[model samples]
Target chain A: MSSERIITVRALTRVEGEGALHVRLDGDEVEDVRLSIYEAPRFFEAFLRERSIEDVPDLTARICGICPVAYQMSSVHALEAALGITITPTIRRLRRLMYCGEWIESHSLHVFLLHAADFFGCASGIELARQFPQQVNDGLQIKQAGNALLEVLGGRAIHPVNVRIGGFHRLPAAGELTALLPKLREARSAAIAAADWIAEFEFPACEFECEWVALTHPDEYPMNAGLIGSTRFPAIEVDEFEDHFEETQVHHSTALHATRRERQTPYLLGPLSRLNLNRDRLRKPAREIAQRLLPQRVIHNRFLSIAARLVEIVHCLDEAIESIQDYRAEGEASCRYAARSGRGCAATEAPRGTLYHAYEISDDGRVRRAKIVPPTSQNQRQIETDLAHFLPAVLDQPDDQIALSCEKLIRSYDPCISCSTHFLKLTMERR
Target chain B: MNTHSRITAVLGLGSPHGDDQFGWSVVDALTHCRRALPSIHVRLVKLRHPIDVISWINDQTQVHLIDAAVGCPIDQVLRLRCKVPTEWRTIECLPAKGTHDLSLGTVLGTAESLDKPIESVTLWLGPAQQCSPIQLMSARTAEAVDACARKLEQTIRGAGPLADPNSHLTPQSVPPSARAGAVTRAEDFDGEMPDSRIDLER
Candidate 1:
C-alpha cells in the first residue's frame, strides 16, 4: 500500500477549454487539491489598448466561441456608458432578445452535450448517445433550435457579426423574428422535458455554505444588464465592481483568481447563483418548473445546476417569444455616439456567470485602457475551494472514480477557461 | 443516374489556433471554386467541435474532413479514408494531438449509432508544426492548405462516373480502404507520406 499518493488528470473531457486536477493524499486523509488552469494567456487586455473604441464589440467577441454574445454585450455596454449614450427602448428589447438566443444556445449545449454525460456515467456525448438515443436526439434538436434563433438575429451563430456598440448593425425583420416562434414553442417543451429528466438523476450529497453572487433585476431575470448582488452583500452598481472585487494572480494558474475585496473569500456565480438570487423574477412556465424541481428558494446543491440551466432556457425562450411579439421596427439599428474622455464599467450575466468590462476611452476614440473580468476567473477560487471540500468524501473511492467525481464537480460550473486563459491541458497522477 | 448528381460536404474542424486554421483555409479554397465545379453539390461548414460534423452527415453521400494533425512531416499532406464503425458502442478513442477532447472517429461512431452515417468519409490532413496560442497559421501549414484543396478537387473529379447518385450504399460495399474498420492511408496516392499509426477508433 502506498503511504503518500498524488492523483492527477491530464486532460478533463466534455468541458470547453483545457485544465487539470492535482490531489495530494496521505493515507486516507486528503492533504491538498488544486484545480490548476494551464490555459495560455492571449493578452486580450493588452491588445485592447490603443484599438479604436468602435471596433471593441467585434474584437472582444472573439474571447469565447461558446459565449461571444456575452463578451459583445458587456463590451458595448461599457463603451456606451463611457460615451454617455442611452439606446432607445426598441434597441434594448432587441439586445435582450439577442441575449436570450445566447442563453438558450449556451445553456442547452452545457446541459445536453457536456454535463448530461456525467449523470449517465459516460465519458462523452458519444457514450451517452449509445445508451440514450432519444435523449441525445432531443438534446441535439433543442440545440439546433437555439442556433436557429441566433442565426435569425445575429446573422451567424458563433462569433456573430451583427452586434455593434449601440445596437445591432441590422435588426431582424418583423417577419424574420416572427418565423422563429414556432421553433421556440417546440423547444420550450423539449427544455421542460430536459429539466424533469435531469431532476430525476441521483445527485451527490454535498453542500457548501458560500456566498452566492449574481446580477439582480426588479422586473426580469438579469441578462443584458443589472446591479451586481450577493447573498452576503448588498447590490452594487456596475461602476462599483472594481471597488468591491479584486483579481489576484496565483502561481499555479495563468488566469487571475477573483475574490470579494472586503471579505477576501471566494463567492459562487453562474446558473445556480443566478437562479438562487432571482427565482421570483422568472416567468410563469420557468417559475413553475423551478418550483416543481427545486422547491426551495435558495438551492445549495451544485449538481442541481443542470436543472437550473434548463429552467433558465425555458425562461429565455419564453422571454424571447414575448419580446418578438411586442417588436416594432421604428428605431435605427444603432445609435450614433461621439467619443469622450471618460471611464465606464458595465456588468452583464454571461451564460456561465457575471461578465464585467471596463474601458477608458480617449477623446480621439482610441482605447486608453481596458479591463475584462470573465466569469471563469471570478469562479476559479471558488472552484478550488469546492474541490478542497469535495475531496474528503471521495478519498476512500478508487482513484479513477475519485478523478471522475472531481471532473464532474468542475464541469458543474461550466467554466469557460477559454474566455480567460485561452488554453487548458489536464493531467492526473497517483503514487 | 446523372454523373453530376452527388452531395459532397467539406467540413473544416479547427479553432483559431495556429496551423489549426489550415482546415478552415482548405474549406474556404473549395468554396472559392464552387461555381467552376457544376457537377458536385458542395456544402461547406466551419466547426468548433468534431461532433458537429455528425449533423451534416445525414443528407450527404460523401464527406471530406480537412484538419491539421500532429506527427506528420512539415509541409506534407496525407489523404486517408476514415473507417466508420458498424456496431454502436461508447467511443473512447483518443483525439489527434492538438485537437479537442472528442476524436473525429468517436463523432462518426455516434452518428452511425444515431442512424445518420455517411457512405464515404475522407480526411485530408496537413502536418501541424506550429500550434501556439496567439499564432494564426504557420507558413508551412499555409502552403499545405492550397495544395490539399487542389488535391481534393482532383480526387473528386477523378472518382469516375457516379453509380446511382441517390442509392443508399451498404456499409460492406464501401471501398476496402474506406470500409468500416480502421483508418488506413491511401497506398497509391502521391507525396512523401510517413507511416501513420494513429488509432482513430480505440
Candidate 2:
C-alpha cells in the first residue's frame, strides 16, 4: 500500500501579491512540485500598443508598486534606445540614485517585514514585531529613509512621476539633493546595523546546480544599465535576450514561465544571482559588509538571500549618500528625441532581479509592440526547481513545518507576484 | 492636548478604479477644507494599499482612515471608531477584504502590535461604485466622498459627535442626513489615478 498525504495553503501571506505551491509525494519520495502564479494578467503589453512613447515610463511604473522605479527605468531605457537618445551623465547618475531608493525600501521591507518571520519561527511580521519591537522599528526607520529618497527624487514613493524617456521632468535642486544627505547618512548606519543583525540568523543549508544570471557592468554594480550575463552563458546584448531566453505559457499559472532557450532549464535571477555575478562591483561600505556577512564570497544557501538583500541595502544607502553628496544639476532636465521606426530593448536590475523591456515604436512615436519579462516570471522555473531539491531534506518534518519552510523558500527569492501574477495557494499531496 | 504626541492622521486607501477612489477623493476634498481646522494638525496620506496605513500611523494618537466599502448601499456612509489594542497578545479584529488583501483592520491590528499604539482610530467608509470602463466615481459615490470629508472635518473639530440616528454610522454619532450625497469628480483631484484592475482567469 502506497502512503499518501496532501497539504494546501489557500492564500500565501507576507509576500507581495498572490501565488501557491503544490507538492506531490509518494511515501517518502517527491513526485512533483509547481509554483502556480495566478496573478491576473494586466495585459500591459497590449496596453502599451498604440500608446505614445512618452507615456511608457509612467504606464509601466504601475506594474509593481514595490519596484515601480525598476519598471520606469527599464521602459525609459528601451524607449530611449528606440529613439536614439543618449541622456547625460547627470541623468544616468540620478537614475541610479532613484534605483538605490527602490532597492533600499524593497530589500528592507522583505528582510524585516516579510522574510524575518521565517527565521524567528513566526507566522508573520506582526508576530515577529511582538517579540522584537526594536528590530521592527529599526527596519521601519530604514525603510522610511528609502521612501524619503524616493519622494525627493521621484516626487512620490510608490509610483514616481519624475521619470521620463530621455531624462526627468525636473531635476532636484542642489539644496534639495543636499538635504537628503544627512538622512541617508543616518540610514547608512541603520542599514549596516541591519546587515549585522540579519547576518546572525541561522540559514538552512542548501545549494542548487542551477545557472545564476544578472546584469553585469564593467565598472560598477548593475542597476540602470548592463549586459545580461550568467555563469553558463556569455554576456549578451539586450536585443539578444529573446534569442537566449523563451517565455512559455504553462497551464497551471497565469504568469508565463521563462527559461534559457538553448537548454530549456531553470535559471536563478535575483539578489543571489546579482551578488554572485557582481560582488566585486559593490562600493566600499557595501563591499565591506558583504565580506563580513558572506565570507565564502559565493552564497550557495538560498535561505541566506536575506543576508544578500541586507548587503544590497547597505550598498544602495552608501550609493545614495555618495550620489547626493556629489550632486550637480547640469543642462536641460531631459534631452529632445524624435521617435522613429525601430526596435529597442533594455535590461536593468530591479530590486528583485533583472527586468527586461523591449519595444517596437512606429514612425509616429506610437508603441507597436512591447514585451516585458519581469524577474518573478523568470524565477518561476527556478523556484520550482529549488522546491524539488529542497523538500527531500525536510520530508520527515511536521506537515505544518514543511509548509512553512516551503513558503520561506519562495519568499527568499522576494518574488513579486504582484508584477507577474494576474498569484499563491499552497497545496501538498502525498500518495 | 499635547500637540507633540497627538498626531491626527487621515489615510485614504483606494485604487484609481471607479468608486474605489473614494478614500483618495475624500482626502483630496479634505486638503482643500483643511484650512478651516487650524487648531489640529492633520497629516493626509494617499495610499494604494491598506498595509501602508501602518507606516503612516507612527506615533500618531488619533488616526482617521477613509476607504470604499464594497457591497454596502450605494449612497451609504459607514463610520466606525476603532479601539487600539495596547497589548500584542490581544487579538484585534482584522479588516474585512476591501479592494486589497490587507484590509484596514489588518493594518490596524498589525500597527497595534508595534511599539506605537494609536489611542483613537476612526474609519470613514463609503460605498464602492461598480462601473465598467473604470474612469471616475459614479454620481452616487461622488456624494459619499463629500459627506465623508465633512464627517472628518466635524470629527477633527471635536463637535461632540453630531448626534445622528443613522444605522450605518457606528462608534460615533452623526446625524442620518449628514451621510447624504457628498461627491467629487475624478478630474477635480490632482495626480493620476491609475486603474489597478487586472484581467484574471482561473
Candidate 3:
C-alpha cells in the first residue's frame, strides 16, 4: 500500500474573500477534500442583537465593501415586509437598476482584475498591467462606468449612503440619469464585446454534477429579489430557507460552511448556479448570447462560469438601459417605517449568488438576532472536491500551471463571503 | 512642422505589498495647482504598476513615474530619467504576458514604432525599506517621505515633476527626534515583509 499524502493550499488568492484547500490522498483514493475558510467572521448577527432597525443597513454595509447594495436591498425589503409597508413601482425599478449596476461592477472587477490575472500568469492586477495596458484600461473603464451608476443611484462606491427601508432618501435628477444614457449604451456594447473576448480564451475542461441552487424570478433575471431553489428542487420563499438549509461552523474553514438540512454533502451557488438554474429567465441580448455561447447547461463545470458571467454582464447592461429609459423622478425616496418586533428574512440574488439574511427584531425595531449565509460558504465543499479530483490527473504539470487552474476554478464562483452578507440603509430617527 | 508639443505627465506606482502610495502622495501637495498645469494640456496618470513607465507613455513626452524602486542598501527615494538610448520605451521586468495583453502591448509598441515619440520620461521612485508582504520600510526610507514631499513641492513650483533619490534610506540617517508611527509609512510596519522579490513590475 502506498503512503497517504496530504496537499494543502493556504490563503486562496484572487477570489473576493478568503479560504483554504486541503486534500488527503490515501494511496491514490481521495480520503477527504475540504475547502476551508479562515476569514474572521464579524458575527454581524451577534453584533446586531440590540441595534435599532434603522441601523441595520449601515451595520450590514460594513460586512462587505463589494456588495453593500445587496445587503441594503434585502435588509430594507425585510424591514418593509415586517413593518407592513409597500413601495411604489418607480422605487422598485430604481432599486433594480442600482442592483444591476452592482452586477456590472462586481462582474467586471472579478473577470478582468482577479480572474484574468490567473489566466495571464500574474499574481495581481498590478502585475497584469505591465503586459496589457489597454485591456486593463478597458476593464477599469467598465468598472468606472458601473461605479458611476452606483454613485448616481446610491451615494458612493464602497459604502452607499443613500437608501432606506421605506424608499430612497433622494431620487436622481432627470438630467443626471439622462447623462448616463451614452455611457450605458457604450457599456451595452462593451459587455457584448467583453463576453466575446473572454469566451475565446481556452478554458480548462472542468465540470461538476452536484446540485446547483439560486434565486429564480418569473419575469426578471433574478436580481435583488427572488424565490430560492435549485435545478433539482422547487422554488421556495425566503421564509422557508432555514427549513431546507443548515449553516454550521466547520473545523476546516473560518466562514460558516453550509449544507442541506438532511444531506451531509455541500451544494454550489453563485453565477454558474444562477446562470444555469435560471437560463430561461434571461431576457433579450443576454439570452441570445447565452443560447449562442454558453457551454451546454451544466453549472458544475467551473470554466463555463466565465461565459455565464459575461452573459450576466450583458443582461445587466440591457436591463439598466431599459430601466434608465423608463425612470421617473417623483416617488417618495423612502417610506417612513415604524419599528416593530418581528422575525424577518429575505433572499436576493447577489452578484455572487443567492444570499439569505434573517433578523429577529425587538419591539423598538432593534435587531435581536441576525443570521447570514453567503454563497461561497455553501459552495466550499464543491470547491475542494473539484480541486481534489482534478489534481492527480494534472500532477505532473508545472506548479504555476496547476496553481493557475486552481485559482481560476476558485474565482469562477466569484466567492464573495463578506459582501455576500452585507447591506446598506440610512434613517433620521432612532428606529 | 514648426510647432512641437512639449508634453508632461505624472505617474503613480507601488507594490500592492509595500507602502508604495507615498510615491504618488505628491499629488496631494499639488491638488491646489492642478488647473494651472491642465491649461497646458498636461496629463496626470494614476499607475499602480512599477515598471510600465515606458509602455504607458509617449517616449518623447516628459514623464514622471513614481513607485517603490528596488536598490540602495538604505531606504531612500530617487528620481531617474530615461537615459537608456535604445529601447527606452520598453518597460523593465514585465510580469504578465497573456495573449490578449501581449496583443495590447504589441499594439502600443507598434504605435510607438510608427513614430509615436516616446523618449522623455522620469521615474520618481519611492524606495521600499523592506519588500516583505507584511514588513515595514526601513526607518531611513520612511524618513524620505517628508523630504520627497518637500522636494516635489519645490519641483511643482517649477511647473514639473522632480525626484530626490535617497531621501529615505538608512536607519542611521533617521533623526532621533522623528518616530516611526508618525508618518504615512506606518503601513510599512503594518504589512508583512516579503522574502521574494515582486516580479515583472506589473
TM-score of chain A of 1: 0.96
lDDT for each residue of candidate 3 in A231-312, tens digit (9 for 90 to 100): 7778788899899999887785677767888886777887878887788888788888887777665656687776787788
Model 1: per-residue Cα lDDT over A339-406, one tens digit each: 78988889999999999999999999999999999999899898888887887798778776787788
Worst 10 residues of 1 chain B by lDDT: B178-187
The C-alpha lDDT values of all candidates are: 0.74, 0.76, 0.61
Candidate 2 on A220-328: residue-level lDDT in tens? 9999788898987788987899999999999988999999898899898899899999999998888888888885556778887888898898888888888888888
Give the lowest summed-lDDT range of ten residues in model 2 chain A: A417-426
True-contact fraction for model 1? 0.27
Where's the lowest-lDDT run of ten residues in candidate 3 chain A? A422-431
lDDT of 3 by residue, B17-134 (tens): 3454455454444455575554464555543322234344554465665555443223445443343322222223221111112211232333343343443444454545554332
TM-score of 1: 0.88
- The residue-level lDDT of candidate 2 at A111 comes to 81
> Cα miss at B133, model 2 (Å)?
10
How well does each candidate reproduce the native contacts, as fnat?
0.27, 0.19, 0.00
Number of colliding residue pairs in each model: 13, 28, 43
- What DockQ values do the models have? 0.29, 0.21, 0.07
User: Local error of candidate 1 at B60, Å?
Assistant: 5.2
TM-score of each: 0.88, 0.88, 0.72
